[model samples]
Target: MTSTAASPPILQFTDVSLGYGDFTVLKDITLNVARGQVVALMGGSGSGKTTLLRAATGQILAQKGTITAFGQDISALSAKQLQAMRQRMGVLFQQGALFTDLNVFENVAFPLREHTKMSEIEMTKVVLDKLDAVGLRAAAHLRISEISGGMARRVALARSIVLEPELILYDEPFAGLDPISLGITAQLIRDLTNRLNCASIIITHDVPESFKIADHVYIVGQGKLITDGSPDQLSDSTDPYVQQFLHGKPDGPIAFNYPVTPAFEQWLQQRKS
Candidate 1:
């Protein structure tokens, strides 16, 4: 990611409603990430965190409202213009999502070669530098499938920052990672955002882990933003759903099988008899 600067927002989503066909997965999302801050997006599964992330980076279409990135109106940009705008975005999907067939070095170099006219020799320098930043320079030639999960995540992190993008979108960066791996990943992300100075939006359920690094936090539920504030505010919130999610409570306004309660009860009674 680019080095930090006290710049204006690198990404802004204004009343955005995003989805496919007629279903709106993310509705009226409004948030802005200025340069040099890590904004965490928190919610339960199906809360539209991933959908919103995709929209912010111009990966998914916005059916209504506007999305701006790198000072360009992303929803209004042409296909080629959107592609150009994407050159400024870096994304790390859940579980790294590395190409299992490619080696680490090639995986990281893929974007550089595809987007730029740089010679292979120059591209190697960029790839190696990015690998070094994520402490994976030694794993360059290993196939992505050979690396441990944590290592793979780090490799993906390396690739995401290889372009030195102005904005980074990370989905579930801590999911399924062990405690030690999570610590390493968390510190690495914190350092990278600080050093690169790029804006970041992290989608995660790891409340404490995310709060440790986040400058701001927003939560989504029931197709809308449920709460937004700094880590402290969210942690102390009295909002029933937000509190239930943050604390991992079993019984709250969010029902576990409310939609299927009648069917479940019928089956349970039959088994009891």
Candidate 2:
């Protein structure tokens, strides 16, 4: 939702609950991403951080409550309307989901070619500029297979912001990078969030890295928001769930094991006898 007129939130989820078929992934999620802010959604695996990103980008509709983007209700939009809305936003998947058949330049140019009537020369300039932003302009001709993982992620980042999207959604942006690459990627996220002045939501399990890049953070657990605040506030929180997650503890308010029958343990022990 690219709105230069006012700095209202580019993305908002109000009392939203989203799910797949019979299983709910995120419940009662009320969050907002105003322009120039980078918000991180942090949680353990299967805790619905990625699901929240999916909901924010309209990949899934809310089963309950409202998911709004660009100042409009996502659930109310038609298919065509939703597609148009998505064009104004950008998404970077966990794996650099570049086209296997296309080189770096073409991958970044793909969106401009599909969405705009810009001339090839103009498109080339835009693509190069984005590549430069992520320090990948020199590797513009490299195929996905030829580049390192970090370079691929940088290319993906370039492609995501090529269109100057008002909002960007990043899913596990630091998933599989070396220490140096991880640091570089984290810095890029912080720089781009401020450079583009765009609202962003980063969904990641990497607590330290996410905190370094995020202006605000929300922690989720069992389909619900456990807590939210600045990095320091979250670190200083007394909430058991927040403490458990930040400290990487095995036992706390959130149990380590899934529900199971108490008698099953004894039954297995008896059978061994």
Candidate 3:
């Protein structure tokens, strides 16, 4: 088997640190997602996975180091250049983020309409084809409120892929799904990456499902990358943080309470004064 490492990376983060203002969430991060591979970004609630996504899309500039997408440094891109670069990428948000006023077909067709001048007939074919990939082609006419949460998520997936982007970012793709829906979604993510020959980065907390589909996994906590490896390699890891995250251990290197930072303590002291 040819290793995925031999594949060219679509996204690369080198010595990266991300934050809002003065509060840094992640630091010294280095990771890559190659073509045709699904990389899982696993972490707890406030562990900066979303911040990395923001940096990837150039919504926020990195505090340090570089984020390279498709071999172009994100920070160096001009505004127009960044917009062009974004056209090659897709994002599936945590809540599906479908348009409430549009029907299923229109929702999926939104990207094609906004980005391409394809005729209605051509757009119809493309929209149906993407919906079919997610097993929701027949729900084309249904309004957003008419579908189940699982079905809505699939519709969002179809919409995200409608442009056939070279890079896809999924934020909590497996969140709030029943077992059957979760399984179907996981399988679809794996199948779509293969079919599109694209890179996928899934920011999720679901371990078993993500492990089953991810080509590589990165776990983060306490403002840094704890570890990264293949699912099997992570399962065999002896690191307390890795073991704690993978097995859902209550007691380990990761504590229950959030740490009290010096900045936070200083603020508290000022309040007391």
**Model 1: runs farther than 4 Å from truth?**
1-7, 257-273
Output the TM-score of candidate 2: 0.90
**Ten residues in sequence with the least summed lDDT for candidate 3:** 1-10
Query: Tens-digit lDDT track for model 3 on 213-239?
Result: 998999999899999989999999999
Error of 2 at 130 (Å): 0.8
Backbone Cα, N, C clashes tallied per candidate: 1, 0, 0
Q: Candidate 1 on 141-213: residue-level lDDT in tens?
A: 9997688988899999999999898788889999888999898888788888888878888999898889888
TM-score of each: 0.88, 0.90, 0.96
Off by over 4 Å in 3: 261-273
Decide which is better by TM-score, 1 or 3: 3
Candidate 1 to native Cα RMSD, angstroms:
5.1
Q: Model 1 — which ten-residue stretch has the worst lDDT? A: 255-264
The alpha-carbon lDDT assigned to residue 52 of candidate 2 equals 87
- On residues 138-167, what C-alpha lDDT tens digit does candidate 2 reach at each position? 999988999988899989999999999989
Which candidate comes out best when scored by lDDT? Answer: 3
Alpha-carbon RMSD of each model: 5.1, 5.0, 1.6
Error of 3 at 40 (Å): 0.3
